[model samples]
Target: MQALRDISGRAGTLLTAMVFVLLLTAFPATAADAGYKAKPEPSSGDFDARKVIVDHVLDSYYWHLFDIADRSYSIHLPVILIYEGRFYVFLSSRFDHGKADYKGFAVAKEGSRKGRAIRVLADGRTPDPDAATIYDFSITRNVLSIFIASGLLCLLFIKVGKSYRDADIYATPKGLPLFFEPLITFVRDQIAILAIGPEKYHRFMPYLLTAFFFIFFNNLLGLLPIFPGGSNVTGNISVTFVLAMFTFFTAHWYANKTYWKHMFNMPGVPLFLKFPIPILPVIEIAGAFIKPFTLMIRLFANMTAGHMVILSLTSLIFVLGSVSVFLGYSISPITVLFLVFINFLKILVSFLQAYIFTLFSAFFFGMAVPKDSH
Candidate 1:
């Protein structure tokens, strides 16, 4: 038992750390403004719900903490850019919340590059066509949120691991480990072992646990309405793509000869199907790629859709208020009720998505390894 606990602790810690490092290093940062500019109380009599939702959903250069008294408060992250082979590093605040140009680069307010840093013309208003190849590596909001989430996981497990390492062999688990141990076990037993088979489950537990908790944690964090929380890490297709690719590579890398044989040449199949058109084999090969693609799309779409629904509901208040203040006030209760229900549902979804992703990953891994290997 002691050895098992020790091994699990080290493995979890290592896997968590690796994820943390990967999140930090994987993507080049992008640009956006500080605080999300809240639409003023509809004084214009027109509310753009689409713009509001897009701003909230998309990644930004700074962390928007909150808005106050028509002023936006945000934590500006560092911006790294390479333009014309020259490296530039500075805080995102230099953009002045997308108001001013800094060092010949400004946040593009129009065109295809809207909301992104771009090289400016001499007048400093138009994008410089000559410097079109600027490479933006700034630390955007989603990237920073990923950093925070990964760091928290690392800290949480590190503390839990230390507790286990320092305690007596027979001591009862307590604190964070008390909460996490069962979860770790659930992934190992209920998901990994059940799907991948007991004999081969041990090797995949670290990855399964990592994927499960990473998705689960990010989902919960994205639901928060405050600083360091609202960034849509999981909703970003890029993040999901990377995650799916990891599973894709892992599955194919460890696939047995039988798995490939079944993919290319299934047993008992009619010769007509295999010989001339090769339709079945082509479909089987496509399924291998499709499996991971579905994983990516499932996570991205669910999280993104949840945020959009919630934002649209919230926007409804302003939309109604634009006509009459009383209408907005009247709708608040109903909107709030719906919001609460959806949020609760989303909480359930957060866990469910994580579980489903991990579950399917285990299934794929199991499919890759022939049953006879066990």
Candidate 2:
């Protein structure tokens, strides 16, 4: 977490531009038509789950390559990078969209085919698909966002670290760094102190602060209608899995000698039970790992599910509610209003989820630590 903040502060121009490319790759490609329909066209025409989710996550990243209003309903950002010689559509899903093969690429003439804009590439297409070839950057929309967000976070912390040592701490925070203090205080007092308890939480403030800010900012970003920030980065399973791993390790690292004995070599167990029926030890050990895993899944599933549900429900107008003049006026407003209401609820949920994950993690750590360590 500390590392993430450092990288954010150090994001130089080159890195920022790369981020621009990465983020733009998330935009949805515009289809052939700009009109709304009563029901969604089956993605099979050239779309699928992989594509929709990809587009949804990469809409901003691939915005120029393709557009939403122009395309029937593409949600994934398209790709473009110099390979061998021909140009290939990115995020098309391996071998499905005129790609080279399952290896996940294709070759075509350089330059824009129809109305497509070839951003930075010298030509629209590459001649050799396998020359400088790759598969969708070998990453999913979710993973890329996590990597970018992690990088941004690292930059933030690096700047903060330097500020603490170079600039006088007594003076007011200057520029953008000023935005961080109140948030840090809020996390320290409202979250860390409250969840981990004041007596033992001071040591964990750095972690708790980072977790809160990361989750909070990302959650807020996910609520937006456009850009890479809304791609459900926080909701990705792999990302969540990593978060669980962190929590699990933290619990273990903080576990004291007493906590270990309680789990494994517990006191007062009967000799027979200790040898063949070590029920308590097994249960304790399993529970230790299970707790963090559960925390991760719970958070990832809930946030992702909420967003999907809101989107699906609100999109009913285009799917089934009809495009009639009165029809839209009559229903779309209410649906949108409700979506906002639900989003407010989701905002609460994001905080609660993060708090729950952190609190449980702390509790698990305290449990794993020898009760008498303090």
* lDDT leader: 1
At residue 52, what lDDT does model 2 achieve?
40
Cα deviation in Å at residue 335, candidate 2? 1.0
| Candidate 2 per-residue lDDT over residues 1-374, each given as its tens digit | 86576446444433564355334322221111112221134342322333243334332232222235444333344455444465555564332333333233343323322112222233323433334433233344454556666777788878876887799877756544555665577667766666566677766667666776676556655655444455586776666788778878876777667888778867776766566788788888888878988978887888788667555545543443343646645776666666666766766676677767666666665565433733
Instruction: Please give the lDDT score at residue 333 for candidate 1.
Output: 80
Candidate 1 per-residue lDDT over residues 120-148, each given as its tens digit: 98777888877858888888989889899
Return the TM-score for each candidate structure: 0.84, 0.65
Per-candidate clash tally:
2, 61
Model 2, position 352, has a per-residue lDDT of 76
